[model samples]
Target: MDNNLTDRSFWKAFWESRIGLIFNIKRDYIFGDMLGKIKAKKGYQTAIELGGFPGYYTIYLKKYENMDTTLFDYFVHQGLVNELLEVNGLKETDIDIIEADLFSYQPETQYDMVLSFGLIEHFKDTKAIIATHLPFLKDNGTLFITLPNFKSINGWVQRKFDLENYNKHYIESMNPALLASYCKELGLKDVESYYHGKFSMWLENKGTQSALAKAFVKSLWFTGKVFTKIFPFESKALSPYIVLKATK
Candidate 1:
């Protein structure tokens, strides 16, 4: 939360995507659990991912979901998808890389699933988002999107950085509620969101009592000791990131 000492050089980890992708999308398949909730229909067999920076989970989707994946990005070469797929030890034919502007791109065919992480907040025109993927989503397809919430640790960082530029800071921190309504209006069947990553949000969500708050919070220190043991998924809520899964 405190950017006072976080030099720009230190922020390189956040800017350099490939490294972050490994830690963000672990081999455990967090998205796999979310996909399990989405049952494919009779003829549904494909999925598309938007803003696929570095293609971290492309291999996972092919291996686990067993569906053809089309990757759409504003800036990707003909072999970006193939390069990542091969880096992950996956075949070249398993994924399709499409380089197009998401705001107006059209898909050749429909898909059973769509993945968009941390992009909705960047764009205000929700219709543009729907137009790009709605036709591509087969009946009962899943749209799994992740974005930062005001309750995330990133918020704390932004808030600190905000001292330099107030407007940019507030924009970086957004409410998850807006996303909920966006999903509902888009004809998404089930809307569920979780607060994940970083520790400040957890502390803020689960309020404290000054009298015994120090003692209780000391016991609840956002550490792996009790977090992994008591509530792993719920612990995600205390963190700084937001992950949502819904169906169309």
Candidate 2:
């Protein structure tokens, strides 16, 4: 049985309201910088992002790294993806978009880089979900995975303000060390995992927030943004994400 916590309808509705919004925070820049550094070393030619619907991060790979990019997702919002691509001065033809389930789809060729941003944590079996990406990676190819650090201060805030969204993620898969260990056990080389990004208090609740709750969350987000600007730091207890990088 498929034990994925989220479904197509959930994502469809989620993207309905966010079709045109491209909110780039400091963490996004940090992640792009990380990608830039990796690109500098390997000069990857091709890349794919599993479960990448609107293809946000993959845009960075396409634009900055000059990679032939593909976004594979179970349910892709093609119109939204096109809109985002247009905003970045890229055409829909620039990215090859394949709409298919991650579990059932098979590619004819592997890629130099395989990525999944905030995808694996939705499934109950962390290792099984992660294993799905390996077959699509070429030998010596890089595998990058990132998930929200829901055991930290961000998790506490989400539980307080956005419990519905918090419950959707399998918190057991949110540990960097555990993720790195899983990569090694799966026979990946040079596996490295660590906490990523500075403090962030953003929540992704589907429900409407009370005025007081909204104010509090806004205040927290503002404070976090300021702190990110002044004293940028990443720690297991405060960072909002866990990143895993490995080679096949």
Candidate 3:
């Protein structure tokens, strides 16, 4: 059974917005720092990102870590993925593309790294969904997962301003401690999970918003950027993402 809370149309509209064009220094910093830590552990050569479409993170893995990466997605939005690759000065051949469903598809070979960003939280069965990625990872290979921390201030903003978007995510799976517990329960070694970014009002909604609400959100976003710049820190209440790292 397809357990995805989000459907193809949601992804299609999401990719069409081209929100990646807007750059956030804080977001980049948090992601880059995490990747650096992963790189420090070992030199990973090959990686596969499950449910990764329009492959921005995979591009970063290639450019920064010099990993041969593969993007595995259903390709319901293939045109947008192709366009993104072209815009990034990459051809379709530059990165391996696998069109498959995450729940049932089996990889031909395992990889040094198996990752997914903001993917698993859409499913109702968090542990079951996470276990599906393990088969694609080689022994001692790293498993990295990141999901929006919707149990924080950002959650409040999302719930109030974008209830529709908030409802799509499985809130029970948003806890860092719970994520860590799940990884450990799956028999992964050295499991670690924690709140990631300091603060950010980043929302995935590109839909219409009230002028007052937009201004309020923007104010909070600006304040968060300035505050994080001065004192970079993350806590359960303020952080925007939860990162989980483990080894198979």
Could you say which candidate leads in TM-score? 2
Off by over 4 Å in 3: 17-30, 225-231
Query: Whose TM-score is higher: candidate 2's or candidate 3's?
Result: 2
How would you encode candidate 1's per-residue C-alpha lDDT over 1-248 as one tens digit per residue?
12222233422343343332333343566556555446344344677877765555455677666767777766654454555566566777777777666655667777777877655555545434544566677777777776556444435434443333222223432455665676777787777766655354223222223546445445545454456456555343356556766677
Ranking by lDDT: 2, 3, 1
lDDT by residue for model 2 (220-247), tens? 7788788778988898777989999999
Worst 10 residues of 1 by lDDT: 1-10
Q: Mark the regions of model 2 whose C-alpha exceeds 4 Å error after superposition.
A: 19-30, 222-232
TM-score: model 2 vs. ground truth? 0.91
Write down the TM-score of every candidate.
0.66, 0.91, 0.89
- Candidate 2 residue-wise lDDT at 85: 85
Better of 1 and 2 by TM-score: 2
lDDT-wise, the better of 1 and 2 is 2
Off by over 4 Å in 1: 1-26, 36-44, 77-80, 125-131, 158-173, 197-237
Q: 141-226 in candidate 3: lDDT tens per residue?
A: 99999999889889999999889889989999998888888899999998989988789766666347878888899998888788
> What are the per-model numbers of colliding residue pairs?
8, 0, 0
